[model samples]
Target: MPGASAPPVERHGRPRNGLRVARVVARDFDGHSETSLDPDLRVFVSDLARPYGLELREDLLRRGVGHSYGEMAEELLAQALPAGEPVDLLILAFSSPDVRPGRSAAVHLSRFCPGAPLAFAVCDQGPAAAFTALRIASDYSRSGACRRAVVLAVEQTSLHHRPAAPVVLPDRHRAVALVCEQTDGDEALVRQSSGAVADSAPAQVRSEWAALGPQAALISGPELALGPQAALSGPEPEREAGLGRDPLGPVVEAGPGQPFTGVWTQLAERLPAWRAERRPVLVADLDRRLGRLSTLALPAGVAP
Candidate 1:
């Protein structure tokens, strides 16, 4: 086990963000191949949908076509979480509804996971929910309420009912788990939420990244792409990837099909390479309908 408490201070010539992410892992699921939902879930969804004059479709109720958050978290944790490693906090963030309804995956995960830490879920805020979870985890460590935290961001493409308006869904089932731990540094990770709305999100994201120089990168979600041109107004990534381009460095975005897990998936895939290059990273995501924007700024070369 790692040290429990470490003051947030600059260490090793690097501005230590309050939280050091020990591990980051993500996976994309092809067609929903999980077992079928039991009778309890079907009854729950059927009653819930009655209010909108919607009934459960036979296809939606079939097996091999849906996902359970609990199941997905289990898989990710198995890959990222070490055996018998105690966790101080566990948070689940998702934009899509899990196949198993009326059950809290976070709480359920706590029971099987080592430490049985405080657990909960954050949702309905779209991509910003993950940032919110990260911010909360950082606050817990800073306040001395926790020693380590795990944040699970999961999104499934299955929506059993029709929406009043068109919604952006992920291309496939995907989930990312971030094991964020306290660093003995005296500084905190940069996290901001609710300031930028749908209209201003792009400008804000661009300005923030523009100041990071070549040792930095910004990975953003599709929600921030609401403006005329969401891509950062800078040179190609090949140039800014330490090749000498705009100060904004490189911009990686979640695609339209992956409205929720896009940015996170990108981060999970590219974190290692960026860490090797010693580049600090920023993740900015938004809940366009809610007009809320959130950003998570990480120090260079975060662990694992």
Candidate 2:
């Protein structure tokens, strides 16, 4: 929200990188409470054996993770927008189920964005939905469809599936909002894929990058398992314990959820490092549920 005062500029009357990224902010659930997964989903949790503890059935519930979807999303947008700056579009990428029945949540959240920006939600796309949203944002910005855009990704782990059905439970509640306009910055959406993988994804991404001829520094979700020689292998690092001591000042912390939000949150926190490196940043997210992968590239300092 720091540097959002100026309107986007066009070069030769065409949108330039000046339609750039403004802010990337992440918020976690207010707190947590010990709870257990539904008996049906419990078996799946037991099999994973992660964060396993205490009573055979009790699991930690990320309470207040999302008090109200619309409110939370709007608050995050406000946090990213400078006072009185209008957002031209709002893109909501969500992987979790909502208490409401339709995409009205996104429409309501757009109120916080001001300027009557067009808003919609991209759902059922799995964890990679955020990348999908990014691609959508890129196209809109590139084509001059919108000068100012906001991408919002929110995830909550509570399940509303059948009692015996398996469900994906996030470690915590989290949301990330990224502000975008046109810019000449190094960042730009390169390639994105969401099709079924015929072979190893690591190999696929590596091959794709090799063809493109630019070595990329990949920042990816945990799902894109990579090995040595893989194209800029992007693996989500474990969450750190302390935060305020970083050389770049306090680092934003990462909470739990689908790997998509986890990787995105971590990316937001690492903006300083990326800016220092002055290298390209590739964000790759995969939705294991749909066997889909979504990726996009950004230049250094895209977040700042």
Candidate 3:
């Protein structure tokens, strides 16, 4: 491990201002056809807005390409604050975006809520994005950059649908939001273990391997309710062999199930290590396809 690269450093320091979650509003495209409004998105937005005494605006609709991060941001902002008050923070969560090269949410925020502080976080698929937004808002509060923040997470898994292949769609689209406010009390969720493990870390290797054993189990789980195994096969023999040297090197690719299984496996094994190390961990599983969305948080009492 001597030459092993250290995990990327997180920006840790006092926040510029006492921050808090004021409100959260999110939307998804669920129960709606590819050409219709994703009902799940509307429900998500409604849930967050209602709790905070807000309502969804007609202008704020899910639109644009399936990759609608910018569109979602604009819609959420419009619905959350119809009167257009100056916002302190804005966080957008999405699985995909219209543009790959630029941060679509940031771009949209710049145009819609230009003066507000902005942050973006992605999650594992869509449901997880809501959680990611909460964490991002919490980080902002901890940083003291803002007093109130808006968080939105949306996902569209429909793109993965392939008629030729046996597909497992779990209500396909979901969106959620949270409003975070700075608090002097204890954190709602303690940060446990954070920092990225190298794609070569032993922990990472064990996780990927353990995942192979349970991939079938996940596909068969009643919660996920995926049907018979599709024609999809495991990774090529040559690729599978290469994984040992670089376990995180992206071998053994399959559907979403494989990567998710690997991450849960990693968390199950690593969380205990973190606890043994005296860290209170919160596991964040992000989109493997998007990369680096996963995070672990060790709470205040935990050791560095």
Cα lDDT of candidate 1 equals: 0.67
**Superposed Cα RMSD, model 3:** 14.2
Clashing pairs in 1: 6-184, 7-184, 7-185, 8-185, 8-186, 8-187, 9-185, 9-186
In model 1, the worst 10-residue window by lDDT is: 220-229
TM-score of 2: 0.66
lDDT tens digits, residues 119-165, model 2? Answer: 99898777666666766776666556677888898876555333344
For each candidate, the alpha-carbon lDDT, in order, equals 0.67, 0.55, 0.40
lDDT of 3 by residue, 78-152 (tens): 766666665567676554322222344554565686355565555434324444455556655655466666665
Model 1 Cα lDDT, one tens digit per residue, 41-80: 6777778788888756667776536778888888788787
Worst 10 residues of 2 by lDDT: 221-230
Q: What order do candidates take by lDDT, descending?
A: 1, 2, 3
The segments of candidate 3 whose C-alpha lies over 4 angstroms from its true place after superposition are 1-20, 29-67, 82-85, 96-103, 123-133, 160-174, 185-187, 190-304
